[model samples]
Target: MSIHFTVSGLTRNLFHSLGLDNQRAPRPLNPEQSLLLECYLAGQIPESAWNDYVFETPELARHVNARRSQH
Candidate 1:
């Protein structure tokens, strides 16, 4: 007999066995991060400062890049 599991099911099973199925997902941007992103998008924040901020938190970089792509 052959057994089949979908890719997602296999991933889920792996995570469950590793006790990582309950790990929290990435959160939405908080108000402060939103405001900073807005300012950066609006050209209010200098690129140097924005680069520094994004470098400090790669998650913020992802958020900013996603927002930029939407526009």
Candidate 2:
């Protein structure tokens, strides 16, 4: 047996099962990360949560920092 991924880079079966696409899937954020980033980008996350949140998901900090440096 063989498996094939679609143009979006995910297996067609997995895409259908997850109901998420590259565009719809959060950019720079892995699917495993919680939706906290969605809220963070929207500025909804409280200051109190920033420390713990970034500590648990440091990649988010790195991604944002890199984008800041590029511009």
Candidate 3:
């Protein structure tokens, strides 16, 4: 049987090939969280919405903060 790779599996392989193994593993986001993140990045959401999203999705909040620090 052939092996099927998910998006994340492909991402890991790409990272490894690029010698970026030390990177933190990606966190899986639910549908709602993903949409919220997209909106936040696009500046389509308000601060109040972001605050509530952070409270509800603490893990994603940490991930977002880490990305911010990198930039």
TM-score of every candidate relative to the true structure: 0.57, 0.43, 0.51
**For residue 49, what is the lDDT in candidate 2?**
88
Cand. 3 Cα-lDDT:
0.74
Off by over 4 Å in 3: 1-26
Q: Cα miss at 56, model 2 (Å)? A: 1.5
Better of 2 and 3 by TM-score: 3
Residue-level lDDT of model 2, residues 1-71, one tens digit each, is: 99866676556657656643222322477654537666765688886787687778656665555545657
Give the alpha-carbon lDDT of every model.
0.75, 0.60, 0.74
Clashing pairs in 1: none
Instruction: Give the worst 10-residue stretch by lDDT in candidate 2.
Output: 18-27
Q: Per model, how many backbone clashes are there?
A: 0, 0, 0
Please give the distance, in angstroms, between residue 22's alpha carbon in candidate 1 and its true position after superposition.
22
Sorted by TM-score (best first), the order is: 1, 3, 2
| Per-model root-mean-square deviation over C-alphas | 9.6, 10.4, 10.1
Query: For model 1, what is the alpha-carbon lDDT of residue 34?
Result: 84
What tens-digit string does per-residue lDDT give for candidate 1 at 1-71?
Answer: 99987999998889867856435443588888889988988899998998899777646766665666668
**Model 2 local distance difference test score:** 0.60
Which stretches in model 2 have alpha-carbon errors above 4 Å? 1-28, 32-34, 69-71
Q: Could you give the candidate ranking by lDDT, starting with the highest?
A: 1, 3, 2
lDDT of 1 at 46: 96
Pairs with backbone N, CA or C atoms under 3 Å apart (clashes), candidate 3: none
